[model samples]
Target: MWTTGKVIERIDWNEKLFSLRIKTDVEPFIAGQFIKLSQMRDDKRVARAYSLVNPPGCDYVEVLAVAVEDGQLSPDLKALNPGDSIEVTPKAAGFMTLDEVPKGALQGKHLWFFATGTAVGPFISMLATDEPWQRFEKVVLVYGVRLGEDLAYLDTIKQFIEQHPQQFVFIPIVTREDYPEGLSCRIPDGISSGLIEQKAGLGINAEHSQVMICGNPGMITDAQTALVEKGLVKNLRRAPGQITVEKYW
Candidate 1:
């Protein structure tokens, strides 16, 4: 299941967030799926799952990761350089995709994407594909970050919003920013104050909306609980689905 790839580029978006583009021979995977990357030393292999940020059909795979100060994989990952080869697992896994949504539920309905840190990876993947363009009437992305500098993909997301003026809404929230523009207090605050509803114009009602959430455990849990309190349910493969969630941590 593991393959090798050379690091093609390392993008420093901020002091805490970085992205790596790896050149690999593996085939593309769905937008919301993740790949496990490994490195071998001595007799042991260390690996971690990272959501692919590149859209399907790209020649290279890109992964965005936030570096926790003393985290195991991140500090080393952030130090990678071009031409350095890293082990990558071929198989991609996760259920947080459009395919998991009920057959007709997403069609002509508003799709709300909630994310924090690297969780924006999959949503960016979904936005690049024709899936969101053709299936949903509207797409609202609420990305929460600790500081304004942590909003790494805002430029890309803004460009997408500009290009698809009628299709998508991009909202970036900074929890620790003092005077952030185009930023709100937090995801939960946005939801409770009806700011998210006002921006999406779909309200928080379950009938016309389907939400996909990804992020740290606490953020994901809190967001999911808030959505459920507003009447959303977890999507399951067996019964066929509502909200899809993937926890980065």
Candidate 2:
């Protein structure tokens, strides 16, 4: 079912990237899930799934999105201003949350998040919760984008660092341009080349690392392959393993 949501706030990170905070009633959701936004055109419904950026229990829901060229619904979403009304899913859905990660002895010492473009939204939601901090010894977020300007939620990330300076690590990756603080290669390459682990000052293995990957499918595929080479396996409900993934597009 759909619910009417009013845009309460909007943040434009760049020409193509933006965030919408909407006021609406949605079923309680866990972090790392997504909700669908919709619009009707010529009696046809146009809808897309957007990962929630805000954590659970918030009065309003937030979503980070990019205006894809010639996209069916994203452009319309990009044009929305505060007070604009939109359609939202009453229930959020997805299985990429930390809940899917193994618990007890299987839970690794370090939690790594690999995201690209707007896919970083879900990871941000997960980080906002207390589960990651309380469950692992180290939490690292590796965010990749075309340019430094595309890196959204830096302020919130900074706050996380301030609060857990010793436990949190943020790594930025800018592929198309120069970013002094980030790597200039794709995520898979970084992993295969050992640059990612080197920068984290921690190696990834089956025993010590649990990786959650989101964003571009290309990155997900290749990054998963690299992790597998390092002895990590795909996480499943019946047979839990180290790596969990969700493809954004």
* Best candidate, lDDT: 2
Residue-wise C-alpha lDDT for candidate 2, range 1-249, written one tens digit per residue:
999999999999999999999999999999999999999989999999999999999999999999988999999999999999999999999998988999999998999999999999999999999999999999999999999999999999999999999999999999999999989989999999999999989999999999999998899999999999999999999999999999997
Kindly provide the TM-score of model 2 when superposed on the true structure, using C-alpha atoms: 0.99
Error of 1 at 238 (Å): 3.3
List TM-score per model, in order.
Answer: 0.93, 0.99
**What overall lDDT goes with each candidate model?**
0.81, 0.96
Model 1, 170-242: lDDT tens per residue? Answer: 8777777663455656686677677778766668767777788888888777777778788777777776446
- In candidate 1, stretches whose alpha carbon ends up further than 4 angstroms from where it belongs are 105-108
The Cα error of candidate 1 at residue 15, in Å, is: 1.9
Provide the RMSD of all predictions against the true structure, rounded to 1 decimal.
1.8, 0.6
Index of the highest-TM-score prediction: 2
Error of 2 at 218 (Å): 0.7
